[model samples]
Each structure stands twice: as structure tokens, then as C-alpha cells.
Target: MHDLIVSPFLDGFLAVRPGSPACVRLPTDLYEEVRAGADNTVPAWLVQTAADAWSLDLDGKAARSALLVREPTELAFARASWEINLYCNFGCKHCYLGERPLAGLSWDDKVKLIDIFRDSGVLWLQITGGEPTVDPDFEGAYRYAYRQGMMLTVSTNASRLWKPDLLRLFRDCPPYRVVVSMYGATEESFDELTQRKGAWKNFRKLMAAARNAALPLRVSIVVTDDNAHEVDAMKAVVQGWGLDHHVYTNMQPTFSGEGDPLLVQSTEFLRKRPVFEGCNAGVTFFHADPHAKVSICKIGRDDQIDLMTEGIDGLRRLGEISDRLMLRTGGCTGCSLSGSCRVCRPLAKVYQEAKAPLGMYCQHGDTKEMVHP
Candidate 1:
């Protein structure tokens, strides 16, 4: 049978290009699918080889064996998300944390957690929060992690970063990424999501600060019904700023509060095109919340394994969970949600119907269903 090796470049559609009659790359080996339509697409051999290493398993393994060997690391990193806080000032219509950042760990607990992550060789730590910068000890925590040789990332609203000291801190030790969420191009659109009047101004200033620092930055805009038309305009603005970035559309609804009730689209008016396949949350990446909760995707934090206690083995155990949720869970087995689910996991606490899947959002002119549960 023909063998296919998946690579980081493959997302949403490319995966299914080889269609049901393709093969894929596994961690320790290759996975050759007798029927490739659902899992992947058959691209030109050169294209596939350039993105991934693959070969035809002419040794008759598929004929003799129904089971295939797979590796999790090929898709998932050891650690991707570092939950810094549960609290967020936005109290967005859809909030996954459910609660705000309540209490923080003691200094000892903080040190221990960082120590564990360091010991595990986790270099990229995504520092998120209801608002991570809001953490009373955010600077301290960031310094500690930096000192430990961990690269940092922050997902924030960009409102709290106006302080001169904070700006300097970012300039000196800027995160590998500072993913600022821009809800809209105008105040009306943005304020609706953030429910704050000055948010637009704050975000703009935040961008200015980053520009002044010449720090690396990525602007993440959540496309909803209201601002879907402005996706390209927004992207152009970021581009005009001369920053390296990608604008993405989330298929999942907001975790809490009023969700984005925007209609899904098939065409691309914005720079961000429709991602036919969903995220590979568990398969390609994983998250560890501030509470030490380990999940396949950041949105799957509600129902998750506490990695703080379970450790690396616990992450490995998640492979079974990911497969079960993606493969055996009825309609979701081969749905379009697979591509955008870069942050998806089976450990979510909420469950929606098959057609009305959890975290449903618009993509490619269709209402692409997503799962957070």
C-alpha cells in the first residue's frame, strides 16, 4: 500500500487530499491506510516528501496486520499550554475557564511546578490567563521561567500592558509570542466582545508599545458575525505594522457568556481563509492550565487530567483518550472539525449534539462543528 507521512505543514484539507486512499506518518513508524479518504489527501509525492518523510510499505505489513503502530509526539509536544491564571477581565460571552483567576499557588508551589516542567525539558511555555498580565506575580513568574531557560508566550487582551515597566519588561525579555486578541476593527465590534469602551484604544496602544520595543508579536482576531467582513482589513493592518503573523478564525464558540453567533462562510473575504479540517488539538499539541490541569487543547481545560500530580506519564496516557474521542465518538470520527481542532481534546466537560457540536464556528461557507468536550 502507498504510505503517507503527515507533516507540520499539513492542515485541514491537505490531510484529506490523499483522501481515504492514503497513508500517514506515525511517531515511530508509518501508518498506511488501506482507505485514505477520511484521514488524508493524496498529494504529489514530491509535495508530501518535502513536507514529511514517507515511503511505500511494500513489505506487505498492511495485508498481514490490521493494527498499526503510531507515536503521539509526532503530533503532540510534551507541554504547550501553561495556565497562568483562570481570571480574565473580559468575562467574554464564551469563556472556557468558567471562573476568574481565583487564588494563585504559593511561592513553593510555583517553584515546584516550574521545576517539574524544566525537568521535563519543556522549553515553550504558553502563559495564558483570564489575563496573565493581571497576575500580581506575573513579572516574577515570567522572570523565574525565563531564568530557567523556558521560552514564554502570552495570550492577552493587551489592555493591561500599558505600563512603562511592563513594556520595558516585554522589550527586554519579550515572549516568543504575545498573542493579542483583537475582537474587531472598530470600537463597536470590539467593545461588543470585550464589553469595554476603551478596549480598542488599549489594544492599539499595546501594538504601539510592541512596535516601539520592536518585540515579536502575533495579533489574534476572533472572527464573529459582526466583524467577519473585516478579516482581511485586520490582517492588512497587522501586516502594515511589519510584524510576522497569521490571522486565524476560531471554529469554537466562546467558552462562557454570550457566544459568537456569526454565520459560517465558505468564501474568503478576509486574509484568513476557511480551514476545512479542524485543529489537531490533542494530536498535534496539548495544554497545561495554571492549576496543573493537562488537556489536549486549551479550550478542553474544564474536563482534563491534572498533570501537576500525574506528570509526564499522564500526558502519555492522554493518547488513548485522544484516539477514543477522535475515532470512536460516532459522527466526530471524520468530520471537518479535525483540522481546526489544533487545540481540541476529548477531556472537555461540555458536550453538544452531533450536528450542534460544541464550539461550533463558521469556516469555508459552512458551519464547521467543533468539540471542546
Candidate 2:
């Protein structure tokens, strides 16, 4: 049978189209007889491989098969997301944390955790937070991780980007990328969203600092109903500055079930049931909260496993949960949502308790379909 290995680095398996046919997972050692695909459009490393014949016999293999591989496969992770600190000075209207950063792993513990990711073969690391700069040891943590050979991505508000220490750090060791989230296009709208006056002026200064330092930068405008009218203006302003930018309309859900009324996308724009083959969340990507709980993905936080201990083995275990969830389940059994739920898992507690969509999960789109408890 013709097959192609989708991700050799993790959960190595054949790539198949949505509802293509039945497929099975195999051990790495059993993978044999690989030939490269001739198509230049495909990844050169994605080789075409064939499966071995079924052997029902007990004394199955030869001594030569045992020595084919000289060593056990190395643990490899392509990317990671770290919530370094959940504390932010600004009270964003759409923040998911919805709380002042009260507690988390200490600075030294954070450094050790960075080492763990490095040792486990994570090449790209994203350091995020309620705002990463809020952490006391932000500079130290940033420098330590970059020195370990990780290409880092930092998401911040630009509030602390120009601090003497951070500016020095950036000049010495530039990050792979920096993303600043602009809540609005003008001072009034920006101040309204962050509830902090003079924030837009600070944002402009941050841009000036970024330009002066020649740091790689990308800006994203969070388009909400409150600032929907400014979407085109924001895009034009950001592009006019000669830097890359994008816009997102989705709103974050707070753990307390207090979702923002003004940020939900319209039904016409709501994502409906679309065909998807599969996702690489726990398999290829992982998100760790400030407390060090590693979840399969951002939306699957409540059911996450602890990564404070067991380290790599703990991360590897996440794949099993992801694999199981990717299969059909009750209510989804033979239902249309089954094929479409490639990476989807259960939504937060409010949805389960209410049996309805919450926030962006609200495919029903309008307020009429969403019942407020």
C-alpha cells in the first residue's frame, strides 16, 4: 500500500486525507524499506515507505532484524509554549486569566525548566504570559534560554521592551521573533480596551525603540466588536509602518465563565463544521501554564497533565490522550461532528454544565442560540 510518513519527529505515521480509509500506528523500529518521493513540491525528507506483511507466527523475525537499528530513537520536540508568568499590569477586557498573577514557579525553577526543554530537543520556544516582562527575572530567563540554542519568540505588550536591561539583552542577543498585540488603532479605543491611559503613546514609543534597535518585529491587531470599525485603519497604519501585521477576531473565555459580550464573531463568520484530517497538538506542540501543567493544546487545559515531574516521559504520554480523542466518541459516533472534530476536545466547564457553546465555541453565532445562565 502507498503511504507517506507525516511527522517523523513525533507520532510518526502515514499522512492520509480526511475519511480516506482505515489506518494504524506502528512502532518506529518496524519501519523499513523507505524510498524518497520524486515530487519536488513535497518535502524532500518525506520518504515513501511500505508496510511489512502481517506475521501471525510466533517465531516471527531473524537476528539480522534486531541489529538493523544501532540505537534507540532520540526524543525530539519541534516547538513549545511557556506561560512564564500570568501576571499583567494591564487589565485587558478579553484576557483569559482574568486575575492578577498571584503565584507560579520561581525564577530558578523556571531556569531549570528551560534546561529540561532544551535537553528534550525543543528547538523553538515561545515565552508568553499575562505578560512575560512582569516576571522579576525576565531578562535572565530570556538570556539563559537563548544561550541554550533555542530560537525564542516573545509575545508582549511592549510596555517593558525598552527597559534598560531588556534593551541591552535585545541588543546582545536578538530573539527569533517578537509579537506585540495592539488592542486598538487610536489612543481612546486603546485606552478603553486596556483601561490604562497613555497606553497607545507607550506602544508608539515601543515601536520607535524596536525600530532603533532593529529587532525583528510582528504586530497583531485583536479585532473585537468594540474596535471593529477600526479594523481597516489599524491594518493600514501597521502596514504603513513597513512591519508585518495580522488581525484576529476571536475572544478568550475566562475560567469563571464570564465571557466578553462584545467580542464574539458574527454567525456568518463563525467557523462551521469543516473537514479536517488530524491535528498535531500533543503530538507536535504543547502548552505549559505558569504552574507547569502541560496540556495537549491551549483549549485542552482543564484536562492537562503535570510536567513538573517525569519531564520528557510526561510529554510523551500526552500523545496517547490526543490519539484517543482523535477517534470517534458518543454523541459523535457516526455523527457529522466526528469527521470534522480532528483536533477538537470538550470545551470548558460552562459548556458541559450548560450543554451549549461558550465563547468562540459558540458556533450558533448569535445571542438567540446562546443562553446566558
Q: What do the candidate models score in CA lDDT, each in turn? A: 0.55, 0.62
Q: lDDT per residue, candidate 1, 1-373, as tens digits?
A: 1223232222211121111223333321223332242333333443444245324322323322322112223223434677677777775543445557566676666777776665544546788877888877788888777655455787888887778878877665556677887778887777776777778888788778767776557777677565777777777887899766555554433345323332342134324434434455565457766777767666554347776577656666555666555442433455565555422333222334222344333222243545333
Stretches of candidate 1 exceeding 4 Å from the true structure: 1-78, 94-97, 254-285, 299-303, 311-313, 330-373
Local lDDT at 290 for model 2 = 86
- Using TM-score as the measure, the top candidate is 2
Error of 2 at 373 (Å): 12
Model 2 RMSD in angstroms: 11.9
Candidate 1, residue 29: lDDT? 20
List CA RMSD, all candidates.
13.7, 11.9
lDDT of 1: 0.55
lDDT of 2 by residue, 297-352 (tens): 66666457776776657777777877765554433446544444423543423343
